[model samples]
Target: MTEKKDSPSFEETLSELDAIVSEMENGDLPLEVALGKFERGVALSRLGQQSLEQAEQKVKILVNEQGENQLHTLPENEQP
Candidate 1:
């Protein structure tokens, strides 16, 4: 019987992406491994970005305008 591995949470993916960047920047990994890590990092980055975008669509940040809180829609997929 094979056991299924659980997917990492968003925070975990972000953390892994950060580690990958650090490892690549440190210039320690061999070319092949570095390339593999870069590819994985790109996928993880896209996943993280998509997750953030979905969450943003659900939540609205209220802005203070004319002394009143107004619903302010964030620019789509614009990272802070």
Candidate 2:
């Protein structure tokens, strides 16, 4: 089979995570299947977190000529 692309986008990963949670909560999956789903969910969570962190690092904050505070790229450690 052809290689798949890199990990899903943040929004897509989050959607998959939500689906996994709903599936787990429904209590219908076999033990093995549930475990697999849980593992995949964890991976997706990590991907989402990493994406957010990268975006944050690229963020910038600036003050306009009018002396109003404006948000540019966000710092990795600080929220916009």
Candidate 3:
């Protein structure tokens, strides 16, 4: 089995990002605090996007005009 990462999972990151959005939308935080949360949310968004892209790449299947399906890993350069 693969070793677990120390970082938060994509789901958890999204949950935190949602909480930040809810808090910011309430319009109660001080400017500095809201700014900090906004930055964190942006970082989390990027992380989530990257995770999605990686997942998409991993599951890719190629079909040629002949209708044969090819299963393969990403090219060496694209591997994480």
Model 1, 28-57: lDDT tens digits are 899999999999999999988877876664
Candidate 3 least-lDDT 10 residues = 57-66
* Per-model root-mean-square deviation over C-alphas: 8.1, 7.6, 9.1
* Residue-by-residue lDDT tens digits, candidate 2, 16-47: 99999999999999999999999999999998
Best by lDDT: 3
lDDT of each: 0.79, 0.81, 0.83
How are the candidates ranked when ordered by lDDT, highest leading? 3, 2, 1
**Roughly what TM-score does model 2 have, to 2 decimal places?**
0.68
lDDT of 3 by residue, 1-80 (tens): 24258767889989999999999999999999999999999999998998887776555533344465665679999999
* TM-scores, one per candidate: 0.66, 0.68, 0.70
- Misplaced by over 4 Å in model 2 are 1-5, 60-80
Error of 2 at 80 (Å): 11
Candidate 1 stretches greater than 4 Å from native: 1-5, 60-70, 73-80
Worst 10 residues of 2 by lDDT: 57-66
Error of 3 at 6 (Å): 2.1
Clashes of 3: 0
